[model samples]
Target: MLKLVVCVKAVPDPEKADRIKIDPVTKNLIRQDIPMVLNPIDKFALEAALVLKEEKGAHITVISMGPPDAASIVKECMALGADKGILLSDRAFGGADAFATAFTLASGIKKLEEFDVVFCGMASSDGATEWVGPQIANFLDTPVVTMVKAIEENEDLTWTVRADFDNGYRRVKVQLPCVFTVTRDLNTPRTLSFSGIIKARKKQVDILGLEQLGVDPEKVGAKGSPTIVSDMEITSNTRETTMIQGTLEEKADAVLELLKDFGSIG
Candidate 1:
């Protein structure tokens, strides 16, 4: 059976986006009191794995790194048809940038010992850098295909996939033990069901920390992160309504003039 790993993230609820705030000192979003949900695009990645599990008889393990509450998302993945779940939670993992986050995830993935393919979302909803997946591939020394929209062929050790390019799509053939960062266009995710939830109750979610991962303290979180957020601010957008008076010709001219003033037209 093929062994698969799906990486998921617990991001702040998009519905409560207005309530999210950034810390002045840390520059990281203050997640306290805010509800967290699985990253949106990650559902597609998990769906891809689930489809494979159904079609080719594979084992899927879903993993994540976040606070204790993140375990909920991992469990959710199991309810969606994953065989096992793992959560890497620790204080040392806080304030991790894309590179640091990828490093930490790669460390956890390495501990898994064996995997045929690692799937991830193209980007996180909160941090849309689109770097963690490729970075994880780099850390694992595996070839990575990003923005994967479809898996054209999946057989044995070799696979063909269609990925998004600048204007069109490109078909890529990669070997097993590779990483794929999938897009929402890949597949439609299945919803949670009662039977699946009951089955997930029997499956265990193993929570690991820095010690469990055996990663350096200075190399897993903010300390090891190279990128720094120097400044961040929220800007408010306000709109004003202007009424143009006169005939149709006059109104047309006025609109054109306004567009020219705003540099919307030459």
Candidate 2:
């Protein structure tokens, strides 16, 4: 059976984006007041793994790193079809940048003993740095394809995929034991079912702290992170409208000039 690992994250529900806040001191999101759901794109990654499992019997493991509350999303992934769930939670892991987070996740994956494929979202809805997946691949010393929109399994050792680029997409043939950061274009994620939830009741979400993963505490959390946020500000969205009075052709020319003045277009 193929062994697959999908990384998931709990993010503030986008529906409540207006209510989200940032901690001025910690330079991290203030999530306590906001509802948390699986990172939007991460569901696509899980769905991709589930589709593979349905076609060929496979063991699917979902891993997440966040506060204790993140276990909720881990359970949700199990209810969606994962065989096992692992949560890496510790106070020390707070405020981690992409590099530290990937290093910690890579360490946890190493503890899994064996894995043929690893999946991650192209980026988190909140962070949107799009660096974690590639960084994880670097730490694991494995091949990685980002923005993967389509995948086809070949022999046990090889797989084919289409990854998005600037102008078009690239068809790639990669070996097993590779990492893929999938995009939402990959697949439609299924909704959670009651029966799946019941099955999850019998399944457990194992929580692993820094020590449990046998990682250097200094290297796996905020302390190990090299980047620091100096400041952050909420952007104002107030808009001003102007009326133009002229002939149709004149108005069109005026709009083009305005766009050029604002650098909105060349």
Candidate 3:
């Protein structure tokens, strides 16, 4: 069976985006009261893994790094057809930037001992740096393909895939034990089923912290993060409305003239 590992992230629900706040002291997002859900793009990663499981004999292990409550998202992955789940949770791992987060995730994958394939979303909804997958591959010294849109071939130890680029895509052939950051174009994710949720009850979710990962204390969290946020503020969206009082032809001409002035029309 193919040993597949999928990395997932828990993000604040997009619908409740208005409730998101920033911590003035830490300069980090304050999500204490907001409901958390799976990062939107990660669902595509999970769906890709699930497709492989159906076509090939595969055992899926989903891993995530977040707070204690983050385990709920991992559990949801289990219910979504992953064989097992792993959570990397610790107060020390808080306020991690992209580099630190990738380092921590790579450490967790290294502890897994064996894996044939690893998948991650192109970016996280909250961070959206699109660096974690490639960085994890760098840490593991493995080949990586980012923005994968489709898996064209998956036979034996090698696979061929299509990856998105500027305006088009290119076919890439990579061997197993490689990392892929998938895009939403890959597949449609399946919704959670009650039966699947019941099956997840038996699957175990292993929690690992800094101690379990065995990485240097100063190199795994905010301390290890070199990037700093200088400032953060909520943007206020306001619209300027103008009333046009005229006959139909005059109003139409005015709209066309405005569009031309704004460069909205050629």
Q: TM-score: which candidate is best?
A: 1
Instruction: Look at candidate 1 and give me any clashing residue pairs.
Output: none
Which candidate wins on lDDT?
A: 1
Q: Which stretches of candidate 2 lie over 4 Å from their true place?
A: 234-239, 245-266
- 13-107: candidate 2 lDDT, tens digit per residue: 99999998877798888888898999999999999999999988889999999999999999999999999999999988988999999999998
TM-scores for the candidates? 0.94, 0.91, 0.91
How do the residues 44-159 of candidate 3 rate in per-residue lDDT, one tens digit apiece? 99999999999987899999999999999999999999998999999899989999999999999999869988899999878788999999999988999999999999987899
- Give each model's whole-structure lDDT: 0.94, 0.92, 0.92
> In model 2, what is the error at residue 78, expressed in angstroms?
0.5
Q: Note the clash tally of each candidate.
A: 0, 0, 0
The 10 consecutive residues of candidate 2 with the worst lDDT sum are 151-160
Off by over 4 Å in 1: 236-241, 256-266
Model 2 residue 42 CA deviation in Å:
0.5
